[model samples]
Target: MPAPPIDARSQNARVLGVELCGDDGALLRIMPLEPVGLLRAGRFFMLRRVDGTGPYIPRPFSVYRQYDDGSIEFLIKVMGPGTRSLAQSSTGTELVCVGPLGNGFPELEAGTPKVMVAGGIGSAPFYLLIQQALAGRHGASLAPEDLTLIYGGRKAGFLYDLEAFMDLGVRVLAATDDGSAGFHGNVLDCLHKQWEVGNLPQTVHLLTCGPEPMMEAVAHEAAAKNLECWVSLETYMGCGVGICNGCSLATRPDGPLGAWPVAKACVDGPVFSTSAIEF
Candidate 1:
């Protein structure tokens, strides 16, 4: 069997800062007292609220960005009770964090042209990813022009962190269904247009994270072109570790015994190849 992404650990992390961003999203920064060497781009942590109680399972959040001082950040949208509590948390609050769990994105070949497609908060992991790419940390020695981002949301305001990518010298194409952004449609439409006009690189690889329907649509497009694609799945979890089996995902066969297999998202992956799993 493949090696687990990273060993799990529980640490008390202090809230460093919280800033409201696009829409109802909050960017939270936390600093762990203990060093978590496993924390990095595309990985995640399960945060147990300090005042958490019954029915409140620990919440899993992707590592939005990791700082040199070992601080980690999360870009969360307040959609429910758990997130609301998190958003209300103030500086100095202690959260029990368990992770750098799950597999990260696979390394791409150096100099390979790449395109990242994200929907709303799905853009979380890519911030650190872009940072790594800029520093040549992921075997990807890409220049600013070699990387492009196609991001989509319901409206322009939903496309948070556009400037973050822009500052990294990445080309960003924004799409909003309401026509309140760069493209007056979904990201798939923008990608299709880029394909039609040969605006995309000839040997491009795709990295995407988003709502299931959107990711599935992007996967289909990649399949049609026989291009390589990687997808990060978003799912609910009872425990941030694999023991709960709360985040199982159906995957394509790795062996001839069967066509489908079940894998734990928390430990096996929050990231997987676009063709390897069923959404």
Candidate 2:
């Protein structure tokens, strides 16, 4: 398995600000004491307040966006004490940040179109992916037309930072369980409709991050269509490093990761080819 980046280390960070997003989510921004250079889109960090306000164990969060000034953002759902503490943090609140962990998304192939499916807060990583892809930073440069984002949420209120994603200049489709926004169904239904209408090609690269059930469904769909797909698992991590083994995922017997019975999401990947691990 791969190891954490050599630059990964625990350091102090100070809250820049926290902006409320969607109904129960927040965009928490912090400036790390040390510069972390540029990180791949799907790489993540473990964060916890230095004060005794949240869980003793730090929570793993995907890098939402990184700024030139050594600041990073995390799109967080305020569902638990750990998240709640981060959301309520004021400017200058001290935090422990450990990261640039795990392998990020694989290089994008040229010519093939890419369709990203995101559910709720899972949309976090795609912003940077789209940004990098358009700039030709990830791999072959892709035009805005070559990329599409299908974002879904239980309700419109759950589609956090929808406007910011739309501003990225790529086609952004919204799917809500209720008919509060864009399409009136889940992301899978939205995807099928797009295919049926010929809005998207039959063969395209698929990337998804979301609730386990949603990713599983998307994986099965991609398999049925014989399309390549990758999933960024939102697995819980006790320690965002190989030592804890808290984020182990069972490997597929016939897949690329078959050499090992299991893989660590923190070091090996939070992103994995659908074929490498069983849903």
Candidate 3:
């Protein structure tokens, strides 16, 4: 099948609403007046507030949810000037956004056992993927029982959208490093326990996004089981269109005869098969 066309637009999007997640953080629901194609799961946008009260460069955010009303959501953690400004903005604020950029998770085959692993805000993109699967979009239909989500965070309060996913009928397993939640360890431990208990299928596909170290650990586990894994990467992007080449990441070449190639995460991918990446 042909690859989906890139859908990047620079528009003034309104802050329709904001749901506070934890202290000093929020989940923003924004709507672009222009009609946009359904943003695939794992894609992101480069957002800059119109007021320009923050940093000059726009920040990249994974699409948390793309609603039918031409609205999209972003899960933001207050970390810097850009995000702080976004978090404090009230409804009706306008944000200049350029995207629906980057590749998304591949459409899974029918009846494939799947596990989605997320670390903190990394859960942003999976919600749309789950929604698509449940709605049978992209010719991929996933039964509720066939999907499991293993989400980890520093504490129970850090795990966002947990109940929302549960309401969608996907089974959820959680872990917190501080032992303040479901499991007493990291999500890797959760995966291990699930495998040990025969809850994990012999053949499984993994979709994950998180800190690089966490994703790397998941990659190693997937490799050990000979499972196919797709990971969504987070990187600093200067230009969401790949013109500045600032989001380049080292990636294994597509063919066998060359050294690892450099791929622009902004354009080449944010979601890549684990085998195609070196780290």
Q: What's model 3's lDDT at 9?
A: 75
Which sections of candidate 3 miss by over 4 Å? 1-6, 254-260
Model 3 RMSD, rounded to 1 decimal: 2.5
Report the C-alpha lDDT of model 3 over 46-94, residue by residue, as the tens digit.
8878988788789999988888788998999888998988888789999
Cα lDDT tens digits, model 1, 1-279, are: 434454667778999988888888898999987877745578888876776631257788899888888898899977788777777788988788878788888775766678899999999988878777767787666787778889899998888777886788888899999999898999999988887899886668899988889989888888888888988888888876767778888887862224648877777678878677777
**Which 10 residues in a row give candidate 2 its minimum summed lDDT?**
1-10
Candidate 1, residue 141: Cα displacement in angstroms equals: 1.7
The local distance difference test score of each candidate is: 0.81, 0.93, 0.84
Ranking by lDDT: 2, 3, 1
Q: How do these models rank on TM-score, best leading?
A: 2, 3, 1
Q: lDDT for model 2, on a 0 to 1 scale?
A: 0.93
TM-score of each: 0.93, 0.98, 0.94
In angstroms, give how far residue 193 of model 3 lies from its true place.
0.1
